[model samples]
Target: MKQVKINRLSDETSAQLQLLTIKDMMSLLCISRPKVYELMQNEGLPFMRMGRSLRFYAASVQRWLIEHEQVRG
Candidate 1:
């Protein structure tokens, strides 16, 4: 298993440090597989390639969501 170095956060947040698979990413973002790939390729979604598989850090993905979130008027 590949290891990811995570910055220390609050206890609750730190506990969530783990790698997420593509399926997990799809579910977490509530999007389709193709869309996830699109985001990874074009939308700057953070990810790492582990051999032939793609992995995402849970906390990083959450932070990305927060950073990318837009307040629609």
Candidate 2:
């Protein structure tokens, strides 16, 4: 299958620290909501809390994946 390379989403989220919710993370990563929450619980993947809600940093998520990526053997 041909892979469609989508440009990485860059935004001024830091100035506003526009943290993304779990729903947004799923869309961004093309993963399930449960998976997104699982990752968040496992690592300190750039998250902040709003009252009782979870919020993740968009840039931090990108960096986190790049930094902690593994190679298949």
What TM-score against the true fold does each predicted structure earn? 0.76, 0.64
The Cα local distance difference test for each model comes to: 0.89, 0.78
Candidate 2: worst-modelled 10 consecutive residues by lDDT: 8-17
Given candidate 1, what's the lDDT at residue 18?
83
Worst-scoring 10-residue span by lDDT in model 1 = 8-17
Candidate 2 pairs with clashing backbones: none
Off by over 4 Å in 1: 1-16
Q: In model 2, which runs have C-alpha deviations exceeding 4 angstroms?
A: 1-16
State the displacement of the C-alpha of residue 41, model 2, in Å, after optimal TM-score superposition: 1.7
Total clashes for model 2:
0
Candidate 2, 1-73: lDDT as tens digits? 9999987545564434557888888888899988877787786567888899988766677789899899999
